[model samples]
Target: MPLSIYNTLNRRLEPLRPRDPKRVTFYTCGPTVYDDAHIGNFRSFLAADVLRRFIESPLCELEGSGPGPRSVVHVMNITDVGHMTDDDQADGGGEDKMAVAGRRLLEQKKSGKLPPGVELDPNSPYDIARFYTMRFLDDAKKLGLKVAIEHDKDASLMPRATANVPGMIALIGKLIERGHAYVVGPAGARVVYFHVPSFEGYGALSGNTLDALREGAGGRVGTENQSGKKHPADFLLWKEDSTHIMKWDSPWGAGYPGWHIECSVMSAARLCGSGSVLSPAQLVQMQVPDAQPIIDIHSGGEDNIFPHHECEIAQSCCAFNASHSGPYAGMWFHPRFLFVEGAKMSKSKGNFFTARQLYLPAPEGKGIAPAAIRLELIRTHYRSNANFTEQGLKDSARMVERWRRFMDTAGKGSTSSDAAARGACREAIAAAMHDDLNIAGVLGELNGWLGRVDAPGPEDAELLREIDAVLGVLELEQAKSAQTDIGVFIGCEADPAVLAKLNERVEAKKAKDFARSDAIRNDLAAMGYQIKDVAGGKVEVRRG
Candidate 1:
């Protein structure tokens, strides 16, 4: 079956066929290195990782004769600069995540929770960027995501002082030459603005009406200088103001490229090769073929579809002109927001949990395993609002445990079992994922299959492993760790009452009354211990 993905550009599910079958170029908007990213942010990333793994995984039959497709290149960028501070704020609506973390650290110090002499380097954005970027990478790794930087191409080419600036400037020059971008004056300062209205199919991605587009444009005026714009909707390509961090000489002036511009430039350079940057004026020459490669999939949070993604499409399409076809990306994917309780996760609300906080040992409060947390976050569909809770984590841990037990019983010696099982599991997983990445449906199916596997044969074992590859939560060794000596001790110390309830559940299951067993499980869960019914009728429970 052809892979079907819900393309935001077309507003429907479409078959995924890469322009070049040999290669697939995908770009996801990565975390800006201003502060520690929240778990909510990682959900979008994890979803992308799953897609990447699914696409890249070699297909095999029961015989295991040949390998399937592998990704020629996969590029995910790290935004170390130009992200606004307003998204972190409720009203200001900018991304001031670093500021929020700084405040929390100060509060911890005042309460004597943080040790004395702890300092955040104030003088250097690069230092700050590197610090948080590493933290983000650590968090992503814990979630089982293989996020590789295109170090040899993009990162190696970047200037140390201003990593992405040089490439960004070169891209802006291409856009200006193509006449897709224009310079505008705002209070004696010049800012480069991309001509958004020129693209006839501007609203195709977001499905916004012209009136809605105008309303959104109205808000962009005060936030930045939009005075020289021909229309209110034009977005800045380069900012003239801003000192001390990173700046490159551009056609506009000595300035930094806009946040959205860098991705277009970098993606083209990496995928299509570093040809002379195409500009609006140069686009009129029919002789020069549109040599820049187009992207197959562009993904991010739904919030970006409007100004961020919309502007990217407009500028890229207009600049490439006849060389390019329609939209920059054939398909667009956006995951829904992850919320803590009912509200959006934020530091100011005291509800946000960083990836580090979720995985690393906490001083006092209970913490879930990194794998369990990842399962919980992805349990719901990518398009659905995932409400995070301790119970949810426990539930995920239980499900993971069940799968692990089945795999262990099936054994690992039969290579054919791995291949056959993986094939069937991939079919099931792909069906769920293709349905708008229906992760909830996928997980539900997994639980049902686990319940049915009494003594899993080689087929069942391989299937479980394949599914686990996509789910990223069910390794037999990790499941063994779920009941290790240290794990039990940690559970006992963290929540003894909950542990007692788990023992009661085990007793109920021993009595052979499933109703009582399930009730006991629920009761123990209320207190925060996730119970898994392993093979041989043994029960393993862990503190969530």
Candidate 2:
């Protein structure tokens, strides 16, 4: 069956057919880099990674052969600047996100979190941007999200927002010249804003009517205030103010570009190759093609559907209409938020934690493995709110261990993979992934298939390995470290509690009560012990 994905634009699952049949260009809205990225942020990243993997897999035909752009070009934008303290503000009244990071670094240094003699340049936005960007990339690596910067044309490219300010200025100028945007405020404090009424498709993405939006806007004015704008809903395109630490010289004044404008400029310049830096007049006179979205897929957290991404669509569509012409993204994909411990992960609730924090050991709390963390992220559907539970983490760890052992045993020799098992597993996995990334369904089917394979044929082993390629977990080296060293044979004395559980499981197995046997094994696994069955009716319970 053809791959189908839920397009947020149309509010339905549409067949994922690229306009350019040879390659797919996808853009995912990345981190704001104001602080350490939490697990909630990584959920969106991991979901995009899964989508990329599936698109490149054999089940999909998006990939094309050539030295040209790979079958997929995934561009993830790092918002290192202009992301405000509040989104409703038209005059960039909120604190600059990079400066926020800078202040945070200064605080860390004062708190002695940084080693002695490493002084941070307080004036440099580069310090904060580079620092957190590296951390975010490191987190992505730990989660095994592929990066496109390492000489891979089809790999994902993470473009920094600050790096494309010139392009943003040019685009904002175009918005002004085309009447899609207007200047607000007076003199040096003038802020350029996108006129909401100019675009007929303004609220199509968020489904908010202009009248309702205007009504809501009365209570949502920014620090500069929207009194000068044509409408209250007109968002800032350029902030011509001196207060921003991360400021640049622009035609409007010496201020930074607004938060929403960066995405439009960067995507157009980087992905679409709109290389020239032209003023609004220059762009309007240039015979640019009819309006069209430069990307194939645009993704982000569900929270960005309004004002942020919605503004992106309006500005980009208007900008394209002026210069190029059309859609911002063929399909929009927004992954639902990831909740922590059954509550919204909030600092006030004391539940928010980063991906790196999960690598630490406890009463500070023992952390979950990165692979297990990734498994937990993908355990639920991308469109669903996933609760990060301790039980779920434990279950994921056990599943990881199970897959490791299965692959190691199945891949003992490179005789061919079991063709039948490989095809069955592949078909099931493809269908799950295609059905709007129904990863929960995929895991259930995979777990059942793996559990039934007692002595995996080469094909079964090969199939499991192939499955791991998309799932992006199952590291045998790490699993080996968790396996029991001396218990490869008959019943060995370990912890008495574990031994007793093993006895009970053995009884359950003999009595043909497989469900009870599996439950006991899962219980042992939750307690940090893996029950591995050895030869001659013996089992080995090892510390995981």
Candidate 3:
């Protein structure tokens, strides 16, 4: 069966056929580095990760389908600048809470009310952005996301460096050259706005009329207004004058590139070439050689459709000249928002859970593991809003424990009847995942299959491994020592002689010597070490 995805542009579930069968270039707008990311932000990223995993999964093809001649190139850009706080704020009334808090803290320090040890750095925005970016990466790692950490790390370390400024300006120059954008002076400020009037079929992606677009744009009556724009729907390409913390030298003077332009410049520079766009044939050629370059799918929250993605489409298409596409992407996927206790998780309500805050302990001192929280987020349909609660997180943790127990049971022994049951389980799992990444459905199928297992067969074992590859929650082997201190238990406390004996026993288990393994376990138990058999035939030794 052909793969199908819901494209935001067409507003329908369409067949996913890349312009280049060999290589598919995909791009996702990454998190802005100004603040700590919340779980809701990571949910969008997880949806993209799952989509990428599906595209790249070996099981995606039918049996007899020899290695398909295709590759997926994924690119997610980190926005370090030009992201205004009011983008998501309705009526532009929302303030940058981080900045507000920083100012308040500064005032307290100035009044000599702060304790002697307390200190507030002058470069609070820079410090805050760096702190949150690092925390975001750590959280992403815990959730098993394979993001480009090296690039992100470099950006975080050198916060002042701007690598793509010249290329970005050139892109804007091309847009201006092609009459897709124009510079307008409004309210004594010269701002570059995309000429929405120039693009006749503007709202085709959103299926909104011009009047609707205007109304939506005009509705945003914030510190920044649309009066300067040629059309109310027009978005800024460059903010010419701003006293914001992060600014760059651009053709529009010492200002910052607009938020929407970052994706365009970054995507074009990384996927297509600088000053050149790839044709469909060239894209195919690039992919055939296993060049995981750009992405075939772009995903985010549903709220990013207008202005954000619309501007991205306009800028990218005009820059690349639609040379290598059936569509800009094979698909545009988006997940729904995550609410806290039936309400939107917002800072105003004090219900917001930043990645850092979530990693911290709850009121009772018990906290959810980052991985467990991630699983709970993914347990719901990406297209549906996930209601987050303490009970919900506990439920997800319990579910993970159940899966771990099943894997452990399967590894120990299996009966013929159990083997057959496991085979059925594998089939059910594949079917569930095939249905538009229906994770909730898959979990339900897992519960039913695991309940019937008296013993599992080879098929069940293989299926469990495959399922782990997709879900990433039941990482049985890795989770064994992930939460505890292995070094402290094994080599830290014990004498050299005792540690040597323990190492020999571990080696025996590695060599599959059951007698030696059992003897070692007995010896460890006699000692202060507690040896427990975990999933995948591995033993976790902890100091008793």
Q: Pick the candidate with the highest lDDT.
A: 2
TM-score for each of the candidates: 0.75, 0.80, 0.73
Scanning candidate 3 in windows of ten residues, the lowest lDDT window is 284-293
- Candidate 1 local lDDT, 1-544, one digit each (tens): 4556778777778777667654666778777777777888888888887776666655311112223554635556677763442122223655344455555555665678653454555345555667666667666766876554333343422212245566666556666777667777653356877776656767767766455755765444343434467765666778675452555666666656676776665555555543333332332332223533367778888898976787777666665546533668867888889988778887798888877676664343345567787888877777778898867877887777666667677785443333444455557766776566677777777776666555567777766677677677763123223344212433324355655665666666668877987887788778766767655554556556
Clashing pairs in 3: 25-294, 25-295, 25-296, 26-294, 26-295, 26-296, 73-293, 73-294, 418-455, 419-457
> How good is model 1 by TM-score?
0.75
Q: Pick the candidate with the highest TM-score.
A: 2
Give the per-residue lDDT digits (tens) of candidate 2, residues 389-423: 88888899888978878877777855654467657
Q: Count the backbone clashes (under 3 Å) in each candidate.
A: 21, 17, 10
For candidate 1, the C-alpha RMSD (Å) to the true structure equals 7.1
Q: Please give the CA lDDT of all the candidate structures.
A: 0.63, 0.72, 0.62
Superposition-based RMSD of candidate 3 using all C-alpha atoms, in angstroms: 9.6
Task: Give the least accurate 10-residue stretch of model 2, judged by summed lDDT.
Answer: 476-485
Flag regions of model 2 displaced more than 4 Å: 61-70, 82-93, 115-119, 148-156, 215-224, 274-292, 322-325, 360-367, 413-418, 475-544
TM-score of 3: 0.73
Q: How high is the lDDT of residue 470 in model 1?
A: 66
